[model samples]
Target: MRYSTYFLGCRVNQAEIEFFEDKLLKLGFEPSKDGKADIIIFNTCAVTNKAEKESYRLIRKIFATNPSSKIFITGCIVPLNKSFINQVKERIVQDNEVLKKNVDNIYIIPSTQKEKVIEIIEKEIIDKPHFDSLEISPKFIQRSKYYIKVQDGCNHFCTFCIIPYTRGRSRSKPVEQVVNEIKDICKNIGNNSDFGAEITLTGICLGEYGLDINTSLAKLLKAIIPYIPENARVRLSSMDLITLDEELIEVMASSPKICKFLHLSLQSGSNRILKLMKRNYTIEQYLDIIDKLYKTIPDLGISTDIIVGFPTETEEDFNLTLEAAKKAKFHRIHIFPFSFRPYTFAYQKMRHIKIDHEKVKEFEKKLMILSLEQSKNFITERQGKEYDILVEEGGYGYTHNFIRIKTNVDKVNCFVKVKIDGIEEEKGNFAVAKGLVTLPV
Candidate 1:
């Protein structure tokens, strides 16, 4: 059987889809590359209205192209939108009873029950399990780079978010399982003999990992360090300010394998807006952490997520955010416009705080421009410096400090020291550099 999997939303979704692919491959399914497949699985997202729209759009496009293929739609979107799920179920029942056709071809599994996807496929398509349960090693799709999901779900219910509703309460993979997974990945890399692999610990809320258990992320990192290969590197995905502490910073700073990059979601810099959004930390606390991180780790790349045009954001509030952005000088800023998601507190409470749509759009434009400028300045600061880049396909790679560098080096999935010569283009978001030398593992 040939199958294709598509995912939308965060890195966690990406990790899940890859896992699905791995399981399907183990079940004797070949991955279809030319958009023609016997099975099409869509792991959808519902982070925002736009995301939901895009998910539906992609589903329509896929169905049009592959009309004969069995379609499986699952992920965060399915569980959150109960009406949509019921609609899909009703349609399937109608097709089965009224048309006397097998409705098993189309399956809808919620994100919570994603583990049963393979089982569903087996019963619905194959009529039985094709293979016995076998231990499968983690696969690194991104040439020598792997994402390990150490945690899943989120606990915090920020006013402007619906992730908590979609993902439910915070939960974590056991510490032993996480460490063993990394070890297994390292073993696989070692056996491949192509190159070393870097593992990125990803989750919906990474810092919230191990909160349910007795251990913490700091403790988990300490435990995994000894088991990891000497050449392998580890990276933390986006984290919240509340979960970050001096101990985790110290652990990262002391470890050579940990990437010197941190991404924190600073939705709004204005204390008033932050409070309205139900964020625990203030601007001062966030800046203090940033200062500490920069002092502790040399050449550290600090990136952040900023939300513009939040509810009750006045001109003064926007100014405060602007000032904070200027002060923080984030290497990369992911700017998002305030999207009103249903069932979120922001959606209910923010109706009275009306800001013009045009005004919100303007603020978004300004913030994006500022972010680009900041990125350009960041690249400019490293113009003459040399850094080791994990050369990927397409002559592109990123340094330990998370600077995207484009080079002419043909080597892929290997390390190379690149001396930054100049900015790549007028925007200056990426640097054009020349490879100085290939670095050994």
Candidate 2:
């Protein structure tokens, strides 16, 4: 069987698809580069209205591209928005009875039982590893340098997020399993080429990695760091500020392999809004942690997520968010407008507060501009300073603590040395490099 798989939404979805890919290959299935395939699987996202609509469109496109292909839809979207799945299934599968029978193979699995999910993936989707062994995909794989999913699901049920409902309770892969995956990845990279890149361990909430078992993230890091290649950089994906303990910070600070970048979620800067959102941490506590991280790691790439307008959010509350953002001077800021998802606590308990759509857009624009400005500050201050840059395809890439640089180069994923020429801080995006970090070919 030849199949082309499309994954939508977060990194976790991508990881799951890779696992399925490995299974499919073990089953003697080949991956399809183009749309021509015997089967097509879409790991969808319902994070936003746009995402859901786009996911539907992509499914339709997949069906159109290969009418004979058996189309399967899975992931966050299917469990939450069954109507969307039904619509797609009806379009593709047609007969109701056959569709029901076929769709059973694509239902979203619970995160609790890894062995069961693994069995389903191996038997139904793909049974063999895509490669003889696990291999890291190309750099354009989207989010991280080397993506590793150490954790899954969300326990912190923030009023606005649908992740908990979509993904269920928080679950951590066994520490040994995670360590083994990292080791395999590092070994694969070593065999392929010299790409001394970072590995980002992602999850719905990363800080909760070892809760189910008694192991802690600090211990996990301690155990894995020794085995990880010296050249490989390690990064922790988004984490809750409330969970950042001294032990973890100490591990990060001591290890040069760990990128000084940390993405913490600060939904709102207003305590009143924070209460409404049911976020575990208050604004003050978030700030205190931010302050500590900055003081502890001077070159830290500190990024955060901020929601512009939540249910019942006032202009004053929104203003507080802006003020807090300014104070934080975050290296990168991800701003999102509130979206109401059914079955979540926020969807039912509180009356949906009407927000001026125009105002929300305006606030988003303002924040993006501020984010850019902050990024500019990092670049401006670092001008003429030499830093290690990872060469990316059609361009060169560099990371100044947390900022990324895209250079006009030939090689992809090769780290080189470059001087900071200019910065684009308004969006907190990047800085221009003066020259290539490598010598002439």
Candidate 3:
């Protein structure tokens, strides 16, 4: 049977869906070139109100387009949307008696048991599967580089977040297991294509990687350094500022194999709002970490996540956030309007409070302007400097500090030294600088 999958979320969700794809491929199932397929897996995200609506809309579209196909819905939406889960079952199956008898075309898998989806397919869709004699690669097939999930779940119960409830407490894969996976992927290293070549270790909460395993991200990094391909580098998914420490900083600073970029989270800058949101850090603390990181790791590109127009966030609170962000000089800011999830602490305690939609838009625009300014400033400073960048498709690549550069280099999937020639004059969300490839590294 042919299969197709859809995922709408973060790098962790992408990695999970890729894992499912690899398994299906190994089982001799072909990918559907068209939308229609015998089996379709759709991974849902409930991180925001908009995302939740989009998930449902896509599910409806998929169902309508593929009337005869068996559909599987999984991810945060499946487990949390109790009424909607039943609504979908009733809407799809239409027979209460049939649902009670455990017969349905639509299957809803919980996020916790999402990895066991293949087992479900084996039992329900396929039996006595023929194994491929050729070895199936253990790395992610969707991209040129390896994307591994070293950890799952979040321990921090931040007020605005529903992840801790849906994903559960932090747990980590063993260091040895992670190292072996890295080694396995590097054994057959391929050229960089689109998305470039790099091993990005992703997780629900990246900095919480090693707390459960009595190890640390630093230790894990050291263990895998010898295994990473010499030409490729590694990048961490978003990290919590509170969890970053001197050890990890040292590991990052001392290694050329690690990307000189860190994506830290600073949800709110107001001290009071931060406490209310349970972010566990003040603006001062956040800046101090930034200062230390910049001083330690030269030319480090620091990006962050900021939620705007949160309920109870006064105009002064919003100003404070803007001020703090300006002071930090972020490489990029992911601006998100506050999304209220029903199971979160903020939803329960601050549901009555309302934020003006216009205010959210105003705040988001302000940050976008700041983001553009920062990108320009960052590129201007590195105007003539040469840096080694991993070249992918379309003659585009990103610097170690995460600046996208367009060049004339044709080599893909390898590192090349390039000098910044000029910046893209056109207006956009962020600036993409122009560079001249000196030589392939």
Q: Against the true structure, whose TM-score is highest?
A: 3
What is the alpha-carbon lDDT of model 3 when measured against the actual structure? 0.81
lDDT of 1 by residue, 264-354 (tens): 8888879998998889989999898788788998888888888877877888988888888878888677777778886789888776777
Q: What would you estimate as the lDDT of candidate 2?
A: 0.69
Give the alpha-carbon lDDT of every model: 0.77, 0.69, 0.81
lDDT of 2 by residue, 4-123 (tens): 888888777776777666555645668887769876667778776667668767766666556555566676655534355455455544554544454543434333332344355455
For candidate 3, lDDT tens digit of each residue in 278-363?
Answer: 88888999999898899999889988889997888888998999899888889788888997896799899888898798988998
Candidate 3 worst ten-residue window by lDDT: 128-137
Query: Which ranges of candidate 1 are over 4 A from the true structure?
Result: 80-84, 88-104, 129-142, 191-194, 352-355, 426-441
Best by lDDT: 3
Taking all chains together, each candidate's TM-score versus the true structure is 0.90, 0.86, 0.92
Q: How displaced is residue 50 in candidate 3, in Å?
A: 0.7
Candidate 2 ranges beyond 4 A from true positions: 80-144, 191-193, 424-441
TM-score of 2: 0.86
